[model samples]
Target chain A: MNEMIENLLSHRSIRKFKSKRLNQQQIETIVCSAQHASTSSYMMAYSIIGVTDDSKKERLAEITGQSYVKHNGHFLIFCADLNRVTIKATNDEYENMLDNLENSEHFLVSAIDAALAAQNAAIAAESMGLGICYIGSIRNNIAAVDELFHLPKHVIPLFGMAIGYPAHHPESKPRLPIDAVYFENGYQDHEDALDRFDEKIGNYYAKRSENNRKDTWTDQMKRRFQKTIRMDVTNHVKNKGFNKK
Target chain B: MNEMIENLLSHRSIRKFKSKRLNQQQIETIVCSAQHASTSSYMMAYSIIGVTDDSKKERLAEITGQSYVKHNGHFLIFCADLNRVTIKATNDEYENMLDNLENSEHFLVSAIDAALAAQNAAIAAESMGLGICYIGSIRNNIAAVDELFHLPKHVIPLFGMAIGYPAHHPESKPRLPIDAVYFENGYQDHEDALDRFDEKIGNYYAKRSENNRKDTWTDQMKRRFQKTIRMDVTNHVKNKGFNKK
Candidate 1:
């Protein structure tokens, strides 16, 4: 593999960070990389909010329940935004566009758009020798995140990213076997050694320096799904004027 | 900017491909890059279907109404998959996870996970000197696509990436201004020169080699959204046992 592919394969999300802020050029380059991601029909339905104010960062960290959000060198909230299109429609008297943006299809478009850009930003940051973690916990308290970010209707914060120098290097988490995730022409589903993957994860956790756990992947997943999580997310998003229809 | 970021910034959707297929090594590298992307709580809620059969590619092209889909170096369908979890739940008898994956939040998680992986694949391909175009048009006939791919329940294909050697390198589509899509601490929305963006897009469309048009961005936006597109997406996903709640 090339150095770029090697860099990509070696990704490990960093939760603990040193206090080293990204310079202006790095930030711009990362954002520019995000801008270049292919959108669905050029509808760049996403935005990045750089939270530099200490208080705001603290509150955002609180919202996510992850201290890294506040303590990271730079915190960015990636938002799925159709508000810009709504703005254009209202300004240009294309009122039907508002209804269009409210559809579930547009919701998927904006969410996918935001995620693609955020992944680019993540890769760009990682290539620059910085460590980053995706903060999906921002969605745990979606209303607070919206309030904290002052997001408008048709714009919702999908996730956050904490970028900085790594204070600790975590082990690269093992992914599903390539056969399990990739199919030939059609999905190939059959019984496999579930214990094999769980064992690999189990070993990784066992050998890791911090927060060791004996739980298998399946156990964690079951524990995760059995409880209600962000049950109001749909209501929150709908009230924000997205997917209301 | 570094070469990687430059490569990311230089992305252009290639509609015309030289009929060269990616070698096994390149394909593996690209998929590895995608596999390394972060997933929500490591659920890894996605799968990829490689449509390598010529007949299937032709069918996919017809489904997408894009000829390039039929003649790419590789075509990959990124799918948001809660079905894998459902299968695990069935095997291990943790049925609550089934209900969990049905929630709207998990739907967003799966979609975001798929997009993140797809973006990584796009970057990895571009780094290897391949061109890519994201195919969102598969949603036009979701049922046909599902039938063609034999997608199981709780697995929805979010998009496809047609990667190939470029026969044509189109100009990078201009995006919204950095100031427009990005904010500081909070979202900043105010009226600016909408005509300026319209002019920028107008000039881009005017200068491009293929299919030049006199339409501005706002005009295209109005035209695209006014037409009801993919009205069945929500119902389709719901029928697939995702996000019905």
Candidate 2:
């Protein structure tokens, strides 16, 4: 495979990072590449927050439940933003009234756009030998994240990513089988596909250090499902101006 | 900028494509690259369906409300899947009995994973000089798409993409100003951000032909938001056996 393909194939999340920081130019290049991503109707309905302050990062780290959030050399929060467009429309004397920005197609587009850009940035960073990890925990405390980031109306933080040189190499985690997930024309029921999943997951856990939990994928998933984690996101998002209706 | 960054920056949606087809090796390489993307906890909660049959593409085109889908040289559907994991867990005697596959975390992870992989595939295709257009309309008629693809429970069509050698070059769409989207530590509420947005959008529309409709950004967004387009997605997803809660 070519270098790009190889890089993509060998990709892994690196939570541990070196203390060295990324320069503004590198950040700019990444952002510029992000801007090059496709937008629906040319409306780039997304924004990114570059978090650099030590104290601020600490607060964000707490909000996300990822302690490493504060230690990463570079931190960014990607957001789906539609308020900007609405505001712009109103200013241009165009009819730009949006009763609900949160639950509208506007939010989904912005979120997806932000995600696309974030993926580009991640790939670019990896190409540059940077290690990165996406912090989904940002949703653990959505309101706090919004407050910390001073997010405007109709802007919601979709995900956070921490970037830096890798301090350690993590194993390439296993993925579901091709047949299990891959469908033909319509969705096929793969009744037997999971037969191999348990074996593979068991082996993966076996290789990990005993100090860590020896739980299989199924076990972990069940444990996760049994409890309510961040159960307030729906209400919180609604309060934050997402009109789910 | 490097060639990779340049390719990313210069990316444009090429609706018109040449009739050339990609070899199987090329397809494998692209899929392999997609599989290499980071998955949440290694669940790899996504699958890709390659569509070479013309009739299916035509149907896909109809579903997406884009006639171009029928004539695209290549088309593929990316799906968010929990079937692989769930099916495996069910058969594994040691695995937990509780079903977590229907939870919000599972749904979100699968969506994000699918999106990341799709983006990687898009980038890989572009690197090989192929043009691609992501089809969001697949979500518009989820049931129709699900039936077309024979999707089982716990699988949702996230998006579709058409790929081929370019027959026509499209314009590079403009992006919102960096500040309009990017914030610092928290979200900065700038009162005039919207006014500036109007001016920039007006500028963009003014540069296009009168056929462009000169629709302000807000006008287009508001039109889309006025009614529910993907209103059934949540219910459809739930019907797919995913407990979004």
Candidate 3:
């Protein structure tokens, strides 16, 4: 594998971090790299917030149910923000912006834009020898997160990422067989595909050190699905300024 | 700007592509890079379908409403797939994999994972001197897309992308101002941020050649938002066997 592919293939999420701080130039480089990502129609309907405050980090850690949130060297939140565009289009000239982002397409565009940029930033960071972990639990309490971020209408926090130099290398997680995913012309729906996948996952999980937990991937997945604690996101997202309609 | 950042900053969608075929090793390298992206819980709940067959490309082109789809050197469809994990979890010692994916978190995770990987693939493609354009209109006819790919339940096409040697270099699109986003400490609302952004966008649009009918960013956004063409996705995605309940 080439350097990039090798770096990418040996990828693993890093949670623990060293105490060193990244210089502003490094952050700027990553941010610029992020800004270089493809935006839907150049709308650039996404924004990122770098979280560095101790209290804020603590609170975010508490909210995400992941205790490591506080100690990470960098915390950045990516938001699907059409608020700027919506209001801009509506305010002057010929169109209303808020009315423009009410559909599933724009929403998808915003999220995809955010995601694309985040990936670039993550790669850029990794190239610089930093480790990172994506924190999806930021959305566990949408309204609260919105409040914490002072997010305006038409913008929602998609997720937060914690980044830093790794104190220790975390084990690389296993992935499903590429055949299980890459279809030739279209998606193949063999009813037994998932069953076969589970066996592989079960073996993968079992091989992990016991410190990681003995639960099969399915067990964790089942537990996650059995509850509906964060189900209000649709309504909360709508209330926060995105019109799902 | 650094070369990567310059490439990123100068990114423009390339719809027209020269008929240059990507080698198998190139495809594998790009995917290996994609697989390096971060995944929530290391689940990696996503897939990419590489379409090179002429008839299949023609059909996908017809479905996405983008004529360039058929001509691109590479055509890829990225999907948010939860069925793989769900099926595995259910078939073995468990019977609730499908149920696990029913929750919003699992759905979001899959989508994010897919987007991250796709972005990596895009970057990899660009690094190799290829141009790319994302096809969000695939959602316009989700059922058709699903059927075309033989997608099973819990797998939804998020977006499609066409990559090839560029026939033309479209002008870079404008982005919203940093002030409109990038809140410090807590999220702060800014007044008139939208007006300023609109002016920037309007100026950018005005600078484009007059013959380009879709000149205004706001206008394009309005066209996207006001149209009801894409609303079928909510039900279409549901029909693919994902229980969003």
Candidate 4:
């Protein structure tokens, strides 16, 4: 395989990081690469917040319950932003601004746009020999996060990313078998494939280097789904003026 | 910048493609790279449908209103899938399957997972000297697209991708100014930066080889937001058994 493909295949979330900071050039290049990611209809309905203050990072670390948030070289929050367009419309005296932004389709567009940009940023950071981890736990308290970032209406923080020089290199996690994830022409039943994968994952969890346990994939999933997680996100999005319809 | 970063910054959508089909090995490697993308809580809440039948491609092209779908080497639909998890829970006799899969948080997770995987697949294809275009227009008639793929409930088709050797390479579209998209510590008003960028975009559009026009970024956005596009996706996702809470 080529270098790029190899780099992509070897990706793992980095939790521990060196104390050194990324230079200005690296940060600029990474953000530029993110900007280059394709957007739906070129709407570019996303914004990124770079948190560099030590106190702010510590607060974010507390919010996310991830100590690594404070220790990373850099922390950035990717937001699904319809506010930019709203502002533009108001300034230009365009009608239907609120109606357009309140629909579920626009909300989905912004969410997908933020994700595509963040993935590009992740890949770029990895290619530059930087380790990165996505912190979805930031959504554990969405309102507090929005307040912390001074986010306005029509702008919701989707996720955060931590980037730095790696201090730890964990083994890659096992994935579902190809047949289970990729179907031909139409969706197909993959119960047998999933059953076999459960055994493989069970072995993987039992044999991992750290935090090892004896549990299958289904076991973990069952425990996770026992109760709802982040149930307030829907209400929060609505309060933020999205999905009103 | 490194080769990988340069490749990322140089990305442009390929609308025209050579009629050559990808070898099985190349397709496998691309999908493998996609599988390596990070998933929220390891839910792996996504699936891919590879459509190679000519008649099916033609139908998809009609659904998307993009003729390039028929000319690409390959086409794949990325799906936000909660069905697999629900099925596993049912088979394993776990409770709360419907409750877990019907929430907004899980729906967002599945959408983000699908986008992350699709971006990785795009980069992998580009690294192999292939071209790709993400077809969000597939959402224009999502119900039809789902029917064409015979998708089950809890599985929503998110977007389609067309990949092939490049028959045409368009210039990269301009993005918003860095200050406008990236903020420090907290969100900031970037009206000035956006105003400056409007001029840059106006020039870009006027000088482009094809579809030349004299319109600023704000102009385009104003026209776009004048009416809602794809207003049916909300109901479609509900029909697919997501966001029911």
Q: List TM-score (chain A only) for every prediction.
A: 0.95, 0.92, 0.91, 0.97
Docking category of candidate 1: medium
- Which of the predicted structures, 1 or 3, would earn the higher DockQ when compared with the native? 1
Query: Residue by residue across B129-189, what tens digits does model 2's lDDT show?
Result: 8899988888878888888877877778878888888888777766656666666776776
Between candidates 2 and 4, the DockQ winner: 4
Give the number of the best model, judged by DockQ: 4
Which stretches of candidate 1 lie above 4 Å from their native place? A90-94, B90-94
Candidate with the greatest lDDT versus the true structure: 4
Candidate 2 chain A — worst ten consecutive residues by lDDT sum?
Answer: A88-97
- Candidate lDDT (C-alpha), each: 0.85, 0.73, 0.73, 0.89
**Number of backbone-clashing residue pairs for each candidate, in the order shown:** 0, 16, 8, 0
Candidate 3 residue lDDT tens string, B1-245: 44545555666778889988888878877777787788876677898998878888888778877898898888899999876655534454344545445554556667789999998888788877889888877877778888887887788888888988999877766655555656657666655665666677677666776344324555566555543557666556555544355
Query: DockQ (C-alpha) of model 1?
Result: 0.74
Task: Put down candidate 1 lDDT per residue, A1-245, tens digits, no spaces.
Answer: 67888888999999999988888888888888888898999888898999899998878777788999988888899999877765656544556776666678888999999999999899999989899999999888899888977898889899999999999978888897787788888988743745677778888888778788787776677677777788889888878876656
**Model 2 DockQ vs. reference:** 0.46
User: TM-scores of the models, in the given order?
Assistant: 0.96, 0.88, 0.87, 0.97
Ranking by DockQ: 4, 1, 3, 2
Candidate 1 chain B has its poorest 10 consecutive residues by lDDT at B85-94
Which stretches of candidate 2 lie above 4 Å from their native place?
A89-106, A191-193, A208-219, B90-105, B190-215, B241-245
Q: What share of the reference contacts survives in each candidate?
A: 0.75, 0.50, 0.53, 0.76
Q: After TM-score superposition, what is the CA distance of residue B4 in candidate 3 from its true location, in Å?
A: 4.9
* Model 4 lDDT per residue over A136-190, tens place: 9889999999999899999999999999999998999999999999998999999
Q: Model 1, B94-208: lDDT tens per residue?
A: 5667666667898899999999999999989988889999999989888888988899888998889999999976777788778887788888974374567888888888888
